[model samples]
Target: MNDKENDSLPVSALQHFIFCPRQCTLIHIEQEWSENVLTARGRLEHDRADSGYREFRRGKRQISGLYIQSEKLKIHGRIDVLELEEINPKGQSNLPSFHLKGTWRVYPVEFKHGQPKENDCDRVQLCAQVLCIEEMLGVEIKQASLFYRRIRRREDVLINQELKDLTRNAIKNLHALFQNRTTPPPINDKRCRACSLKDICMPKRMSVKSVKYRQSLFQPQEPL
Candidate 1:
């Protein structure tokens, strides 16, 4: 076992951290959660992956709900789907694969309840999965996909250096946050409306109180 495996956090926490650090802290640290319509819909969308099935077709192998972890990244989670395509070894005689007959390339797919977001949270989450698989199998994956149930489409994502760097940074930040064991102050922005933990977090009230505290610091001290 790798040294960091014992300290690993969940891969899903990367998405939560990227979306909002405070939200991530509330759930992963404070152990608080609430179910909203959006979250419930997402759970339903992932029902298919909960079965943990494997299938082979058209020279490709597919596995759903495969558990994966990366000691290097210090994260662990279950992948929604993993597709493997067979390829000739060619000049590369030392490629890692399933070890039955042929060399294979990995392609991970993450399922989402909604369409593509304007942020890289989903992409980072998918990339973390790829990193886990690469470490586990010793194969390099250069691309992955996201399946959006709402749009009914699969969007291809390049596992480029930028995305990998972003994913690693997020993982590092997550570990730091976990070590600190502190929930950050909330911004109470538009994103809060759709967040399931809004009521529990009370971002509006918290932000207002924070502002008043700062204002009081600058208030006149005539009576003093």
Candidate 2:
């Protein structure tokens, strides 16, 4: 895909692609969506996060529902919570806005509906947010955090090379999928049960049809 197409893609697509390519395609390419329990809960969680509030605490400034974009990464989206910590400007360069006279380090915090999962989906999403912040602010973000409602705690994520690579690759893959505008077949794993698109996907029925098609490829032909 070209740069224009890539820039048009949403940052959320990375998380969806990590969770399931088919799910990503279903939502982005096919433009299909259904609100199941899990999805509804997630929506509620984001709604709370995107309340558009700003708070000041000690040496830090907390801004919620801030929109960010990165031309380098070709992604744009709204950040859940961005914390800017005041720092002494020893020899640091000035940022674009004079309001931020003192050097401020940015830290992104993403909110989740459930506990930490045994996957890199959430981590990748957080890293993508950091990338956007870095590009926009002209600074390097070394770490971020994820706040899970279930655990009521924050999980710090390091914005390292591995995660950066994974996120970039996922974005490229998703852009390619979007350019082609094709939906991938489902794998019908346990994750499918919780997916909002399960009904529309019909993984089990599709899997059966796929099996039958494969079997028919080798079936003996009837005598004429």
Q: Quantify all predictions' global Cα lDDT against the true fold.
A: 0.87, 0.84
Worst 10 residues of 1 by lDDT: 89-98
lDDT of 2 by residue, 1-224 (tens): 77565557688988998898889988877889999877788888898579998998876889899988878767888999998887865536445552666677788999998899888999988888888888877789898999998779999998899999998887778778877875677879998978989999888887856967866888998979
What TM-score do all the candidates reach, one by one? 0.88, 0.87
Best by lDDT: 1
Query: In candidate 2, residue 41 scores what lDDT?
Result: 87
Supply candidate 2's per-residue lDDT for 57: 84
Q: Quote the lDDT for 34 in model 2.
A: 92
lDDT of model 1 at position 97: 44
TM-score of 1: 0.88
Give me the runs in candidate 2 sitting further than 4 Å from their true place. Answer: 1-7, 89-94, 208-224
lDDT (10s digit) by residue, model 1, range 45-111: 7988867888988768889998899877778999999987767544353334455455677789999
How many clashes (backbone N, Cα, C below 3 Å) per candidate?
0, 0
In candidate 1, which residue ranges exceed 4 Å CA deviation? 1-6, 89-97, 208-224
Residue 100's C-alpha lDDT in candidate 1? 43
